[model samples]
Target: MPKNSYKIPSSLNRSFLDHEVALSGGGFQAKPLPMKVLLFWSGSILTLFWVASSTFVAQAAWWLIALVVIWWLITTAFLGQYSKTKEMKFASVPALLAYVPAAARRVLTRTSTNPSSFYSVVGIDNISATGLIKYSDGTLGQGYLVVGSASILLFEEDRKAILNRVDSFWRKVDTSCEYTFVTTKEPQRVYHQIANLERRNLALEVRDPELKELMDEQYDILNDYVGKQFASIHQYLLLKGDNLESLRRAHSVLQAEVENSSLMIKGCTMLNGDEVTDMLTVLYKGKSS
Candidate 1:
């Protein structure tokens, strides 16, 4: 029998973050405390105290000692789980409140001034572009959003890594489509060519004011949904101690809602070729040759 092999798509493979890219402009490098070392030392000290108390000082019964050990183990496990979940909650809350809103407004921008950091883009465009880049320093993963003028590109990797490569990729695409744009004097034609090369063919233009208004309404609904979902999770975590199942359920529902919102937003924002062309022209009008 043939062995089964699972392959992650190239877009999802973000091993590049492990090694420094030549073109990566420097960004901030996070210098978090060595959590593992702290945890190890704390656990060791606690274990020693527990053993000494059970064996030498208290002379506790076997049953009592066993119960103490069991309790210690359970407490340690619960604390570990709680700590992880809390970190995730903290990270997600800001994205829900700030990042999503900014992206929806289409005024979101990223500053990769740090020599060791990058950010990611999220949300969908009219071209059905939605993906995230996950960046990892072999221990932590950060996500970045990919935004484009005509068609967005999605990847499952870190934002910093994507940002590092963005210039090169944009230049390559521009080189490929420049001739078409210059010859035809049509931004749409260049957009189509670039989209074709990038394997993003779904392009829509939104000219209807009513449809745009409706999409904005739907975006409001999605924002409300996210807020409610987050609140429920927060309440559950506070009232009940770090219920993993509850967190998972909340996240699952939110993910589904976000996906639905992406589709809806894409449909509502679909821009025709002319509109896309004009937008691109305006955006790049200030660029130097």
Candidate 2:
């Protein structure tokens, strides 16, 4: 939990290994430049420039030849410079690297007119949860935005808040624990299901018959916070685990964590929602009565 501490729990460590989930094979992807892809777009732009020069400006044949030469020189020179700068940025950017595997696209994505292979950028637009991105060698990869470990520090409510926490987590994760993000269409409604039950049980706990509805409302927010934790863990697993064994282990760990925080998670049964509710009610009543 400390800023500098890099240790993971025994079970979580096993889960990480079991998943074998890595965003990249190495420090960075080494895809080569896709010259043909680059040429297609660059050629289109050059053609337009030539047409404008000849038709609008009344440039003669020799002038046209000179313009083409100038365009090639400028394109090639700029491309070379761009590639060097991009490599530099990729190698040095701190905390920012968290977004690289997904955010950083290879040079081919930009369709840059820079004739040099080194002048390409990772991607030209903003990074996001899901978007098609082209790599330097013209291979297209989907952007996968994820929720991070750090996000667990704060409770998740909205998608943006969840994303920010995920962003924060990846920035801190020195290890290979990949994080992920997702949204439920009915987060609020689903959250209230457990919350309503918790409040119903809590109300029965005390005979202070005053402000029952008000008391229930007060607990509503707390319940929502608990629900968000569940959602975060679920999304995290989906992003990290691609195999059945790993998902199974992750589910086990999640159930254990939920039970460890029993008061909030309401006993954290391994059973499905219906069974969980039954167990929660029985446990709550045993204590209340």
Candidate 3:
């Protein structure tokens, strides 16, 4: 019998359970703390101790101490929830009683200067038809909607390789430019698209009973999924440049890398001006984009 020869696959192609992406120095860092939680807690405790140890504190009326305790409890609860919210303050007990009316008045008094509007918060000075977003600070940005998946079907090694490529691309890009990857959830809207397709192909479906039955089955599956209000996950890539030229360069580099590399990115769509606007509106206002 003739000798048999077999080829062994490369170790890089072997499936693994997990992988990690290496990052360049300064590519990412821990968030800075302006003030420590421990410091705040220490200060609060010291203040309370100073007050309670005072001569008048011991001689204070019972009702007065009870009122003070109630106030402290209320303020502590409020601070626990809204400490980071600067505009919201616990003015007094009277203010709490009038919260509803005060909230209505605040709504009436809201203005563009307060960052209540999408444009103000987003700082978009202009949006070009070609999908470049110009900011008030002279930065230019572009957004891309990414579609892809990672599941049991995709080996762990493959997932890591794709992530490594993505990390390399980020390190290769201009350091001054800002790049962000965001994942969000939205109500499923794909069923509507399927419904529209079914309507458009009604005549074809009528001519082929088999096709009609298949289409109906698929539509029902999607419709049932939608009826459950299961949120669909969306991924986005946002690139901001110091200037228009830098933005264009970054966009080209991204497109080339994504197309040439096996990053497992199945689809990427650049958002137009209107689409960008709608996206921001939906994000800020909780409305459909």
Q: Candidate 2's error at 250, in angstroms?
A: 4.2
lDDT of 1 by residue, 152-187 (tens): 564434333444443333343321111111111211
Task: Give the poorly placed runs of model 2, Cα more than 4 Å off.
Answer: 1-62, 77-178, 183-187, 190-237, 240-242, 249-289
TM-score of each: 0.20, 0.26, 0.50
Per-residue lDDT for 266 in model 1? Answer: 21
Locate the minimum summed-lDDT window of 10 residues in model 2.
Answer: 121-130
The digit string of per-residue lDDT tens for model 3 on 1-289 reads: 1114535434453233212233336667543322323333345566666766674764788787767656765665554332332222333456567665654334322364444444444677888887788888988899898776556687867867766775577567886578888777766767467868677676563567787778788777677776447787777888999987888888888888768864656678899988776566556564335
lDDT minimum window of 10 residues, candidate 3: 14-23
Q: Pick by TM-score: which candidate is best? A: 3
lDDT of 2 by residue, 1-289 (tens): 2243455444532322123222346577544433432453466567756765666444567777668667866655453332422232222346466547653433332345453432332222321233322234433322221232333454534444445443454554423222333332222226456666666766685666566676666566556564444432222122233343444454455445454532222232223334323322332333323
Off by over 4 Å in 3: 1-119, 152-154, 191-230, 287-289
Order of quality (lDDT): 3, 2, 1
